[model samples]
Target: MPTAAHAHAHALDLGRFVMASPSSFHAAAEGARRLAGEGFEVLSEIDAWPGGPGKYAVVRDGALIAWTVPEGAGATTPFRILGAHTDSPSFKLKPKPTTGRLGWLQAGVEVYGGPLLNSWLDRDLRLAGRLVTLDGAQHLAATGPLLRFPQLAIHLDRAVNEGLALGKQQHMNPVWGLGDPSAEDLLGVLAEAAGVDPYEVGGFDVVVADTQEPAVFGAHGEFFASGRLDNLSSVHAGLVALVQAAEATDAEGAPIAVLAAFDHEEVGSASRSGASGPFLEDVLARIGDGLGASAGDRRRAFAASWHVSADAGHAVHPNYPERHDPANHPLLGGGPLLKINANQRYATDAAGAALWATVCGEAEVPYQEFVSNNDVPCGSTIGPLTATRLGIRTVDVGIPLLSMHSARELAGVQDPWRLSRAVERFFAQAG
Candidate 1:
């Protein structure tokens, strides 16, 4: 178990990380920046890679893969991979975003994934994403509090208290300002923030994000509230663990430790930077080639590898206890979760459960099992996808959370750090 101060410090760092990452592109950039600061060399896909053992990181679109190869690593050395995603459910800006009616300037958006639409109402929001120039240069852009989705006044509809109904196309548009839509350009706002000309932005992928800063509230500072915690919590944990594993000097016999953060998980993860795509495979193949591994050696290495797929799981809500498994109630602050599903929604099986128990035991962190209620269908993670794509053994795990997929979600302050500690132990143990 981590001390109170240590847990608080890790939570503070996680808040800062989430604040810096408004979009998946920004998350990847921020991760790469942090890796570079820790003596990790950037590996460009277009350039040749060095075969020597060292710390290296690569970015592909909104995804990032980083690893540390030990001094004595060889062709048949297995890998310890920590997999997580960078995206959350939100509204994505559509083409011709500028619109207005009756002097109110609004931005056209489409629901990116399954977000809590009601929670998004009346919250301050900002636009963030990558802007690509005509020459194919990409620039990151994020604006301050700029847009808002104001709810209809209860006075207008006295029956609103009975039920609050919202339409995706009719009522979800967020207002930015009062002006003529024909005269205003929303892309110009992002371009100016990015220090680029709007005319030069040939393409863009922008999404709306909550502008409120993350907070540690509740009677003992036990609760953490933030946007994008659905999966950023897992990403931050893996990143911290990877950096710590790289800095340790006793890694002579340890396997290669990898942090693979993919994007588009909130959707179906079908993009090139997604887990279902070839990014991880391509990177692993290159690494194997650098190690001078034959097809047989690579297969042998993969047969012994492990991938820990970390994502957010549901914490038994006080008000909705019936939604979770009656016998297996995961609680916030109790510990990280070892997620399981009978339908293979999660990749964890008996072997994976035993491995998780060993890892948590080695880390001195407590853990809880999470299973969905029989009446409710379980959500899937990158675990099954990674296990299917690559023949490596995988486990699904995460910190428990309440209000998942909301504009701002809730988590226990200690669970994130606990997850990181367990991940560090997993990286240290030889596969």
Candidate 2:
């Protein structure tokens, strides 16, 4: 059960998470720090597993998996998995990124995912991601507003309102300042931002992001606005649920709870730390091995596991109502959404959808159904990929929001609280 004050505090915490996590690497580090604060042991892939009743977490690049094993839990015990991605659509910096013309310096960038490129124009942008040093270790760095993409004025383009054209290679470069550009310029700036020497900075994997802080707004604070809400919001919700479930006991026979946050979701999730890779599958196998499970026991445990894909869902846009399915449109403040697609894009089946409804109803959590218009193709998430990879029962679910894939997105103020509650309940309940 959650109180009003608890909900408010959780919203505030979510805001902090959004502000702190400007990149996927930072998001994973923040998640790991939070889990560690709750006394969850950090396990390394190279080391042997400590088999026993305990709370443990493993990190691979930006992806993470944390689980809680209850006292007297067995090898064949079922698992309750809460899944979310840490990465969002943004402009990733490329190697040899210096570019300049007409006394202006710009940084070369590549689109990481399908983002509304127009929204990024003229916005206050910064750089954040991992900086790998000469020694082969990595360090994270976030610089304040250091870049901007100025838009052409109506005076320059008389038909600007008619239809603005943005070329990925030609128009998306963000200008930082007026100076001579060099190969060492961006790295030097990054090193200075991180308070380290430029010589020590060997390479980097950074991205340009919005520098604006997330806030709760609207009349009487009925809405919230933030960048990277497409997935980090779900990450925060799942993190809260995992931490809370670790502190509470389940029913007489409940499954172990696990939270898996993966990176590279924006770029098709094909990397070593991505959903298409072996990160989650390997982590689950290692968890089973740590529990002293045999091959058959591990298979049985996987058969009994369930995964909830927590990503942000689309709320019917007020200005673009025609784009939504008339009968199945979701709205802000509508609580969690059971996202479904007939084309298998979402991985939500009839049984999984019903299970979501049952959990929401039992927790007194408001929920709605979302099916894309027949003509509008649905987007993909880690749900389908995880289900296929691990052969687990997976359901797609999330909070309703507008302006998805934009530089900044919006959601109802109450939705985050409702989502966190529903996810906590999902971990609390069992088959």
Candidate 3:
């Protein structure tokens, strides 16, 4: 169990991380920056890798993979991986982004994932992502409180207090300013923020983000509210654990610890940098080759490996108790969640559950089991995909949250710190 002061400190750091990571690309870059600051060398895919007994990190688009190799690591040394995603549900900017009618300057956007549409209404928004130049240079851009999606006044729609209906095409466009679309170029705004010429930008991958800063509120200061907490919470936990594991002095026989933060998970994870893609495989293969691992040796190493897939799970909503499993009512501050799904939506099995229990027990942390109601459809995570792709044993685990896909999400302040401590124990534990 973490003390209140320690938990509050961790939550403040998480808030800083969330504020720095407005987009997936920014998340990966921020992760790499932090890893580099901790003496981890940044490796480029185009360059040759110097593997063995060192800490290294690499970024592929919006995804990041980092690992720490011990002094006694060999070709058959097993790996302990923590997997998380970097993306959240939001709207993405479409091509010919500048669009408006009359006096309203609106930007063209496409719904990227399954976000709570009603929650995006009447919130301040900003555009953030990477801008690619014609010469293949990438520049990061972020606008601060530049757009808004205002709701219709109740006086106009007299059926107030009724269900709100938001059309994806007709009602989702956000207004940025009052100007003519032809006269104003939205790309110019991003280009200026990135300190690059607008004409140099050949393409872009931008998304909208909530501009509100993360807050720690609620009775007794027990609650934490922030945007993009769905997966960033997991990513931050893995990062903190990995950094601490790298600094440990007694990691003589421990397995290689890895942190895999992927992108595009909210959209089914089919992109080049997603878990379903070859980015992770490519990095692992290269690392194996550097260790002189043959096919048999690589298989032996993988056979002993373990992957912990961390994502956000639902805490029983106070008003929607019937939607959750009656026997399993996970609370916000109860600890982290060990997610289980009968239909293989999550990859946790008996063996994985046992392993998770052992890890948590060693760390002296409590955890809750999460299962969906039989009538309710359960959501999936990257656990099954990673297990299917690499044949490595995987367990699905996460911290409980209240509003899952809302523009802003909620969590218990202590749970995030507790999750990090458990992950650090997992990383240091021998196979």
lDDT tens digits, residue span 252-335, model 2: 676788999999988999999999999888877877887788999988998988899999999998899889998987888778
TM-score of each: 0.99, 0.97, 0.99
Residue-pair clashes per candidate = 0, 0, 0
* Candidate number that wins on lDDT, 2 or 3: 3
Candidate 2 vs 3: which has more TM-score: 3
Q: What residue runs in model 2 are displaced by over 4 Å at the alpha carbon? A: 1-4, 249-251
Models, CA RMSD each: 1.0, 1.6, 1.1
**Stretches of candidate 1 exceeding 4 Å from the true structure:** none
Candidate 2: give the clashing pairs. none
> Model 1 clash tally?
0
Off by over 4 Å in 3: none
Residues 336-358, candidate 3: write the lDDT tens digits. Answer: 99999989999999999999999
Model 1 error, position 184 (Å): 0.6
